[model samples]
Target: MNKTICALAAATLATGAAASEPIAVTAPGPQGDLAGTLIEPAEGKPVVLIVPGSGPTDRDGNNPMGVNASSYRLLAEALSQRGIGSLRIDKRGMFESRAAIPDPNDVTISAYAEDVSAWISVVRARTEVDCVFVLGHSEGGLVALEAGQKSDDLCGILLVASVGRPLGDTLREQLQSNPANAVVLDEAFAAIAKLEAGEGVDTQDMHRGLMPLFNPAVQGFLIDMFARIPAELAAGVEVPMLIVAGGKDIQTPVTDAEALAEGQPAAKLIVIDDMNHVLKPVEGDSRLANIATYSDASLPVHPELVDAIASFLEDSKS
Candidate 1:
């Protein structure tokens, strides 16, 4: 909901000389094959699985629904430069994994966690690695934590711009932040309340601008997502966890990161001063300029974002 719906410019793929061929990897899903791209640098290097955020995001972190940051592509190249390999994936029913399911909306957080577990096995077997680190961005962070709880092969988690509160509260905050949304605020809240209560909202009376978020097709998934409390989930995470927050991020604020830290206490929290939700550095505070980066794939990811991950991974290697 942070991004406007529009056509996105295609994100340019990054090339790395040290990186191996774009190894196509797949896992058995209930529907079909869950697809991913594994960029193995060499043996012994830790493989970081890049779990993308919500919507129709592809393996490269761009979504045809107006998001073309290429953040995950740049992240993979940066990790490769740091002697770490990466496995970026297209979620089941999304992008290249579209064949995995007939209806992309027919999925839940648990299913994504299962997909992550499957990807981990694929990475370990293909790269001959002992364990893999998962770097989840936004909603993907919740999936990583859920997957980490179910698997012991995880090295740790690097959560970026992710939620740390119940999704209902987060959604309410997101709706209230925009002055333009004032017109439909009451309707949005009512719909969210119903969804949070495990009941489906009848979007027949919904505002045109809010219909997409409360539509019948995605209500089941959204209801499942709303019930998930990120802080509660993070509290049970037994592996090393790093909570990253972008100071300029308009979606999930730094307070959410603080909540995760408070819940886990053991998690390392890093707040990058100028980095936004897209993992890019923005100079101004204007919402328009901040959101402009979503479709601008040319901008490089902030160097500090890479530095943070590199430092964390290096330090955690004991």
Candidate 2:
């Protein structure tokens, strides 16, 4: 454990906001160990497990897909300041958890939900807490919802920048939102339709840019994702939920949060104006300007987001 702590210390030091040393922790995985960083808050403070969003994102919230923003790491640090502990993990078959499975793309939402259950068990044992909060960002919110359906150990759920509709609908809107995608809009829409129908699409001769999104290796996962309607899942989650939306977010807009709140009338919803998809504040409506923040690790996550989450957790306890 000391070696693990030493190895991960530099990364934690970079955050410069964690109240204590970050401990490298592991949860059981299918074939190997799932890796995470656990930052314990002041004694008896509540703990949260930060689930990464889609893609090959690491525990720190950075990925090779042009996203360098350390959103999760910063969020963990900020929460620590609020006396909240956090454990942010690398998904199976990616980054430090690469050995957890043979392939990263061979996955489904259910599998991710199972991993969340495993992580919950681990956090409870380590922290000696009755339960832990689950904070899922973007696509991860879907995983959290699925996990909450069967897991009895969750304190509550926090959905951050998550989509409220089926992934296919969201993908369609995303494609249609950009004028540059006009050339491939028809094909992309067709592919999404097929996936939503539980069928696969032939990507042969497809646009090069579209291939990355619809690659055959990940088609099965897409099919599973398309089948899930986040609103429906939110309706099934019996635990307390906090849905946070960014007003300036282009990906999953405020409408999605509203939909989630509608699905679960008891859930609390918070909207942070000026926050972008990556959780950074964007002053204007420039799409390019908003995207530029995805690569800027120096930019802090929206203060309002941190405040809402901290307050929600505190309130959930009472």
Candidate 3:
């Protein structure tokens, strides 16, 4: 692993009695530098490299796409309080990593997986550890599985709020889940079918509401994503895995987690009943209520989430 330290800055994590100063870290990327934030607890402690989910989410888990919850940042702080270290990163060509590539839309799952391999090398060198655990949230989990297939250096794989089915199927389910989408369901389904068949959809005539999801700029990436079945990837991963799902999550439900665990029978699966897609605890079944948490930065990630991950990592060591 090459030591590519461009600059350093301090970030204080104020979580109860435990706190650690996060340092800015960078790894060499194709065009420029891939940026990340590392929170190290102590020497010899286990470290996790957190991969962000879909779209333009930053290292802190906030994105311009109506997501301001800071779930990843809060999760890192919670883990640090439990004596665990973490490094959360922005995806290549997005956020602080915008310089890594010319266009964020021009990417594939495999490219993201390669970036994970790069981050793992950086994490191992910085922490002086033999291997690092990978905690991938949402679509990032698929990247983890893809990386696991190619590398034997991972301590374990952690899938949080990730879909176990092929991305096309999951997209169909998500579109159908909302009653308001009934008017455009047929069009959405047809588009997904085309993408799954390795064909591009003409979004020029797509519904205004669905244009953002099926934008022409991202169709290439979506086509690549549609071809991947996460369950199949999970089956090929030759390492310990922890699959955590949120029961109240409308995006990727608990069944998706179960499918992953089913694919990898030896993997551990935990379902948190009240947790939403963003890792925040929501009380009811109202769709509006659940989506509200997506923009709320004050809410901390579910307490059980941190505990589940910490416990799984400790148990995996034995």
Best by lDDT: 2
Model 2 TM-score (2 dp): 0.94
Q: Which residue runs of candidate 3 sit more than 4 Å off their true CA positions?
A: 1-18
As a whole number from 0 to 100, the lDDT of residue 267 in candidate 3 is 94
TM-score of 1: 0.92
Residue 192, model 3: Cα distance from true site in angstroms = 1.0
Residue 131 Cα positional deviation in candidate 3, in Å, after optimal superposition: 2.7
lDDT of 2: 0.88
Ranking by TM-score: 2, 3, 1
TM-scores of all predicted structures: 0.92, 0.94, 0.92
Return the candidate ranking by lDDT, descending.
2, 3, 1
Poorest 10 consecutive residues by lDDT, candidate 1: 1-10
Inter-residue clash pairs, candidate 2: none
TM-score leader: 2
Is candidate 2 or 3 superior in TM-score?
Answer: 2
lDDT of 1 by residue, 177-281 (tens): 889999899889989999999999887767889988888999999999988888888888888888999999999899999998998999999999899999989
